[model samples]
Target: MQKLRQETQGFGQAVPPAQSAELIHTNTISRGTKFGFLGPAVISLAVIGLAPLAFAIWTSLYNYNLTKLASMRFIGLANYANVFSDSAFWQAMGRTFTLLIIALPVQIAVGMGIALLLHRPGIGFLKTITRLSLVIPMATTYAVVGLLGQVMFNLKYGVVNQLLGFTGVSPINWLGVPEFAFATIIFWDIWQWTPFCALVFLAGLTTVPPEVEEAARLETKNWWTILRNVQLPFLIPGLTAVLILRTADTLKQFDMVFTMTRGGPGSSTELISLLIQRVGFRAFDQGLASAQAMVLLVITIVLSRLYIRFFYREV
Candidate 1:
């Protein structure tokens, strides 16, 4: 027993507690190792994301117009003040919101309907193909969609007017007239994005447990009742997600307007993004454009937070 105990003590002394702990610690990440792993990510974000943002904010504080380089001076908050009081800027904001108000609901409602239609049990191969086809519009480049809209709404030779001729109606200026131009853009946006909203809602439907749905069906005979009280409750997260994304996107709309109307027909379709582009690029007022962009960024963040707070987990 003494000999065995002596051998055990010798084996234990071979590696001290401190040495064992050090070895274990080395196997895991140390503070320096963690920093090594995260250093590239931090540096990349600072250089790529934060550097431009800091530059833009700094530029916004100055009276930096490209044409009048000699007149450049630090006029703190003057650009922001101008953005608030500028009538054209407000008009552009109003047009952006107007399009959002009209298009958002239509997209959500149509998309939700399509999702419900496609969310049945045991989806077949043909139905799967049909669902996959919906992605084509969403996957198409927005620039391409804008160009397509330009061709489709070209008053005289457009397909829409050509079709109207069959019904004995006169050719109407789709993109030339202010009201029609606005409507045409809204229609084009809806056509392109409704598929995306449908996909989101359909994914939400899959997350709804079959047992929960069965329980709800047992309580309610009406399909509308089940939809309103059961399915919609489970779909809130998806609905809120789509709403926030669409709102941000619609608020910053520029590509379609730029390609199709160029904010023409007396600035009827001048969205906030188009206005910012014109101010920064066309008018060479970099400070004012940066300020406008900051305002847009703030609005997007606030609205997204509001959506998350109100509808995220309420269901």
Candidate 2:
């Protein structure tokens, strides 16, 4: 037994226990190195992103009117209260939400269809041209699209009305009525952004394993079933990402609505961003604008979080 114990001790000594303290020291050094590399980026983010947000929050807390600086009194939360009570503000919010609700599903469905078509095999030269064409609308500026909308939707002599004349339909005032104007904006948004969603979906399609898809095809032989059960599951991540980004962007949409309609006819097209711009710049009520902006920020964050929670529950 003593001899066996001596042999075991010798076997143990052959390798020697690893130096845990040395390993810990090396890990600490690596962590420090990573942080050293990341420090500049962290500082830049704080300066550029966080600093502005902090300033906005601070401004929102105080009654800091740009025009009435001398009379500006710190009325905590009064501006927020006023925004909640304002009828025009509520109207703008309702319109904004209405547009979002109408546009989101249409964009997602059309974009996904486009992506599926583009991803299919057996396309050579056509694929390249199709991709390039789809990219053109997304590449164009929103302001440019809005300006084009203004010209194209003109009542009397616009190309749209002229096109309708061939079918014996009378010239429709595309941008004159509130409903038509809102529809025009939604259509413009869908046209410009559907390609973006398609691109994202296409990228997600690439990540799906081809073998798995083949296996599913063999099992069912029904393309729709495969798409719903296999392709759609694979697309959830891309869909979630597109939804979050588009929701935030659509909520803050200003340039297109501003350029096309100027929130006019009767403030029927006024989105929250337009309202904020009017309050801050036109009305010179910076405090109220800041308060509104803060509320918008909160709403955006909450919506984003809810989406993330719902979509990413598995993760």
Candidate 3:
């Protein structure tokens, strides 16, 4: 073995052939091990995620109405085209996006502030308590949350209007008014999502190497400078993740707005989802409902792809 190694390296160099052979054998086995090792995960993902997506696409092509079974017809791209002409569908798409725009920035800002406060070394106990407290809202069921939102925004006896009444302010129809109704939904979404974003920021903070933060503090006492230059840079990837996740979630805002207003007081706060439900079930226009859904699906897919490409491509 020594002679074989010497011959392969140089006249004076020596190594065992057995060690070289073992290394080569290990490399060969690893190289030949197919990623078929991921078979289960791939299969599970397809069954749970991809299969449903394919099924939705197929259903979108057909007039799959829940009520009028005889009226259901295979309509090809007719539903897809009808989406463009449907004013209600477009309005809903707008509402969903408007909520996203209002919620994402505010939630991200609040979450980062909390995470920054929590990341401080002196506030360990406070951090633990605050984090646990925030988790409660998240743990609460959506239905319950919606119910609470409705009660809170109630024009007559709701606590919010009651609080305003204390200051001699008129008890506005909080849920009935379009402006404040929209605002109410935005607030509810932010309250629920901010903590989640903070959790992401906290994860990013933990990964910042200790020595780097220490060196920054040593150089200067300017907290803002150090945070922007050091911590914020390190947190960009995490920030992107939080933004994308929250944006996607906000697009699906339904129960809170639905339970509170039923898209009433003049359809001012009516969203596409609620519109589709009304058409499909209430109005009994299944084809129109299907078309609206297809449009929604298309918009969601387009935006999701854009976010992935713009922010999460490297990840």
The local distance difference test score of each candidate is 0.87, 0.84, 0.77
- Sort the candidates on TM-score, descending order: 2, 1, 3
**All candidates: TM-score:** 0.87, 0.88, 0.81
Candidate 1: tens digits of C-alpha lDDT, residues 88-108: 988999989899999999999
Q: In candidate 2, which residue pairs clash?
A: none
Model with the higher TM-score, candidate 1 or 3: 1
Candidate 3 regions exceeding 4 Å error are: 1-43, 283-288, 312-315
lDDT of 1 at 60: 93
Better of 1 and 3 by lDDT: 1
lDDT, candidate 3, 83-150, per-residue tens: 78777677878888888887899988899998888998886787788889989887887767878989
Q: Whose lDDT is higher: candidate 1's or candidate 2's?
A: 1
lDDT of 2 by residue, 1-315 (tens): 344334434545322235432333333333445678888899999999999888777777778878778986778888889988999888988888888898988989899898889888977699889888889998888888888888988998789899999999999887889888888899989988999998889888878799998899789978789888888878888888998999999989998889889987688789999999999899888888888898888999999999999987743
* Span of 10 residues, lowest total lDDT, candidate 1: 21-30
